[model samples]
Target: MDFPVLWCVLAFVAINMIGIYDVVHLKDLLPPLSMINAIAAAYLLDKYKLPNGLVALGIGVIFFPSMTAPIANLKILLGSAEPPIIYGKAPYVNPPEGDRKALGRWIKEHTSITDMVLVHSFGTQVQVYSERLSPTIYFNITQTPIAKARFYHDLRQNKPAMILIPMFPEYQNLVDADLRSFVSDLVKSNYHLESIMYNYQVFRINK
Candidate 1:
């Protein structure tokens, strides 16, 4: 066996073992596996002197199952079928509609460009849509003690024009206990609730 092919097999096995213990998605494995498959196929063909028809049939049998989704997507692109409503990371689907979108638009229209916004427990969609800056680039600040301290310091120093907090069901459970308490107390003393969107609370800094 070729050294490069042997290395690829070993790497593939190692990655598979790691995946067994951790969350590894199929998409992450496709690239490396595809290269390995190609190299192995080339080696087999060179060694066996396989007939062209047999090689084509083998390739079709091996790859037909994986071609279904891509073919369907191609059909959709060619306007043969209506696209599905996919949420989260699908470029074809419409932008999500809800309190997040409303709040984003409100912030963009109401606040000045220079004003920073602090979003708690919610992702960076609001800041992205509003085209406003955030005190911290990270959306989740309660991951570690150091991260929490950095976020708190930045929050105090920046003094954002508004704070967005999720009010959806069980949203608070996602946040850290100490961080939640600190933010609640700070908001009560320094900020006031300006408006309540369907699933979010917007707080503006006190004058």
Candidate 2:
């Protein structure tokens, strides 16, 4: 097998191990994850024609975790009356929750921090909505993907002034807190917090 294909297979086995491990250890959490994985597997299976069965299985394993990571994320659609907060691959902007205009204004006002922008999953929003700001972008949700190496890059070099989260929900405060904590861990804390609304909260990073 080619190196890329072999690496994909290994990734699949590792992910399947994670799911199996989750099933064995955290049985309660496995069902939702399993359901999400099943959906992704069945969908992707139909879309991609993999000649090798083992390769297909590997792809399934690798893809399942991202599909099922959020247990209650699906509720926004089935339980809601209005439009969902996520559609297709793009995240749904909850009305009054995450105003693109507000984000743009924030970015426009902080033009000097253009190089410091790092939106986690919705990092694209900054580039999409903030027309006034020409950002160097140390990390973006769509364009830039990384692990821990981006830490010093964002803090030391880029000096990101804020984080733009797009799929920010209305009810899941605890999950939101955890997500914020994860984002905050990446930056230098310039201020305590600039603002916190219902859908999104803006943090004023320490320069």
Candidate 2 Cα lDDT to native: 0.49
Off by over 4 Å in 1: 1-99, 140-142
Q: Could you say which candidate leads in TM-score?
A: 1
Each prediction's whole-model lDDT (CA): 0.69, 0.49
Q: Write the per-residue lDDT of candidate 2 for residues 10-56, one digit (tens) a residue.
A: 65565554332323345444455565666666777678964558767
TM-score against truth, every candidate: 0.56, 0.38
lDDT of 1 by residue, 1-207 (tens): 765566656766765643322233344556666777777788988899978689989889877777777987798789996543443332322234444576678889978999888777744566677788887755544455667777788777777888877665445656777877877887998999988654457899999
On a 0 to 1 TM-score scale, where does candidate 2 land against the true structure?
Answer: 0.38
- Superposing all C-alpha atoms, what RMSD in Å does each candidate have to the true structure? 7.9, 12.6
Report the error of model 1 at residue 181, Å: 1.5
Error of 2 at 60 (Å): 29
- Pick out the ten consecutive residues of candidate 1 with the lowest summed lDDT: 87-96
Cα displacement (Å) at residue 175, model 2: 10
Q: What is the lDDT for 111 in model 1?
A: 89
